[model samples]
Target: MLLFQKLYSRIYKYSKMLFLLQIIVIVLTFISLDHEAIAELPYTSVVLPVHKHTDASKPLYSAEVMTSFIDWQYMRENFLIDIDATIIWHDCSLLWNKNQGDCPTNSCNYPVTCEEYPCTDIRTSSSYKNRYCPPKTNWSTLPVWGLCTCPVNVVNPVTVSCVQVSLNYDNFRFNESNGRNVYTGWDDVYPHAACAPSSSLQSFPANVTGVLALSSSPYALAGYLHKPLKRVLGLCLPSTLSTPGVLFYGSTPYYLLPHSDVDVRSYLSYTPLIKHQNSFGYFIGVNSIVIKKRAVNIPTNATTKISTTEPYTILRTDIYNPVVRRFLKVTKRIPPAKPFPPFGVCFSTSTKGTQVGLRVPDIEFSFPDGKQWTTSTANSIKQVTKDVACLALVDGGAASEPAIIIGTFQMEDNFLVLDLEKSAFGFSSSLLRKKTSCSNFNLTLVNSYV
Candidate 1:
């Protein structure tokens, strides 16, 4: 009985050890299965939100003003000014030709003809003859010199005289050395005032016509001083002219000084008679004052006149580096999609059943490796249907099975359905592994076949 009890205890101990070993093996097997399942998770190529750099700084100038000036300059310099004048004349001629004679008449297709005859005097016997001639039309006349008359006659020559009068009047002077006596008449034997009562304190000369020659006592003044005078007096004097005061006299000798500060100031106050002359004296210290006055009228909001009122959205994608070089063709089954949240897809293409490819419409694009993505079908392909299918290529030996990670499908007329879920990762990973090993595996469609 003692030996049997000892044997039973040993058996129990061995059994417990074996059970623990089995549990450990089961746990290890489970961990390995879990790992394999995780490894098999398919990884699909997905386009995620990529942040792009944007320029949010304000523009250097107002866009509206710049555009307006650009358009104005273009029209003025290119389109409007460069128009052919002959074309305008041709158009005018056509319009005149359409209005035949008086108006459009069903009876005549051409203009009526008119004849001219010179009338004979009753004293002489003369005859008139009818001549076939077209109507007196003056369509070749150009309006020059504000006249439509033809320039065929030059009988009376027209003369245009241009007289240039110098504003300088140095000969006229007032001598204040003698008693206040005004002597302004040049044609009379003696100085005469137009106003009577020579001492009435104010005197003006009367109307005196006819040319008269003058001989000055001083031979030094020959040409200009002794000039022939033809005066027409009694003309109304300007309002700016004023009679000299009782204390003033016309004989005051106002000598012209070389550099008189007072004269310079007075001359500057008067309007300049000569152009391109230094109105301010050479040594006059002149200073410019710039008054910055703020504009009182503020510009309102700019309103652009747009012909089309409909709004549109544009999608532009610039891919610098592509995954493959050769052409690739891919077809993915897209779900129903919407228009919001603007998005696009990028992929490569291939031909081999085991190689990925891009498929769109009638074209199939394939890409091998080490090439840029310049082949696009956005502009070429049109009328993309909802729930469309597309495919992309990976590498030459990569699996050709379509892994749908990005898709767009229309649910309604305006609503679109999109599926961006990465559920095919496990299957894709397993396929890639199997393909690398050159193992034969079923590549049937996942969801459809399953």
Candidate 2:
């Protein structure tokens, strides 16, 4: 740890050496490094907002979004991200806890902008067990004053031990590029799960890739520390065709709703989250499908599960085409036109049906616990070519069972939450409330008392 601090100090002092020598030597090199990136360290304070087709204000989600490129092609189609985590620490002092120094308190900056981890609720919970970080002492002699951080190797419940922790992330996609590598020295406490770098994570062949092990789970950081909060993760998919979306840790979108101040219970729709393989994906049970408020005839054994295909549900492009054909047969809504060359059940935009091509009706999916998400036609029917618009569903390869993956396109303008504590998934199928500002979603303020 002392060596780690010295590296930062030297980098700070000889900042110019970085550009002049063009040598990129990271203290904690985690990702595939690019020589061009040797000029500067990855910036964590810079909040990145994913734009909707290049629009500025209308972004998908805004955060200290770490854009790390990969060498895969799983999520390239829908622009979906898979398996990420937010590492937060209480008491910036953790950076200096292992190794004390004579540097200025603020000079030992940890790159990312972080606030003290609130312990109000944890200290009060039975989980607290009187195991709290000692009260702050004025170590004025050292760079940082008395600070608390998660123990590097010791296993203390995050809420009680006051250690740095990671958040839960539940999307699955692969990036196949040589992007930037971001690292945080404060987070050396992970369980060190081994994950192969640069692998293609496609959403097909349901049983091809089993779930990731908890140890190797990148988002498992939440379970290590966010136990008191149940390790819940809330996400509101992009509301518009071009607008980006927002994701939250420790809280669900329903609890953060504009009108949820009173009865938050009424806003929750839950589905049992069955862990498939290990942590690879959350396998859900789809009871039935209803189109235009009418039930579609599904074979008895034809199973459906919601996988994290992101932007749109995923199935191999070939498999998706066949399902689209079956859906057309069941709905009898419109006749299929020429096949969309690349993939998908495409048709001419000029249909006898109303405004656009083969006007599709509302598709509703039933889940366990009476939870259901009805797709809105506007986002469901996608316009691909000048004269063609296909269903927004993603196309992947063939898997053993029929693929009925619930995608982000179907989840647009909706608030979804992954409640790790309860092992359930909660969501609001309604439109994203334009007035709701996640400012209150601040974890420090909410957990201040603990």
* Model 2 ranges off by over 4 Å: 1-80, 83-219, 224-228, 239-243, 252-265, 293-310, 315-326, 329-337, 341-343, 350-359, 394-402, 430-450
lDDT of 1 at 343: 23
> Candidates' TM-scores?
0.14, 0.48
The local distance difference test score of each candidate is: 0.18, 0.40
State the lDDT of candidate 2 residue by residue for 1-450, as single tens digits.
Answer: 999999999988798876655544452242344433532322211111222321321122222222112332111122223332112221112134235454343323232111223222222333223224443212112235543322211112111133322111122211111111111211112222111111222221211221222221332434443222235655554544443444444432233334445333355678887654422345566665666555544444444554333446665444455456656775465555566633356656765654464556666667755667766665577666666776666565656344555654566556566666687777666553334433322122111111
Cα error of candidate 1 at position 282, Å = 72
Q: Which candidate gets the maximum lDDT versus the true structure?
A: 2
Candidate 2 — worst ten consecutive residues by lDDT sum?
Answer: 173-182
Model 2: what TM-score? Answer: 0.48
Residue 187, candidate 1: Cα error in Å is 99
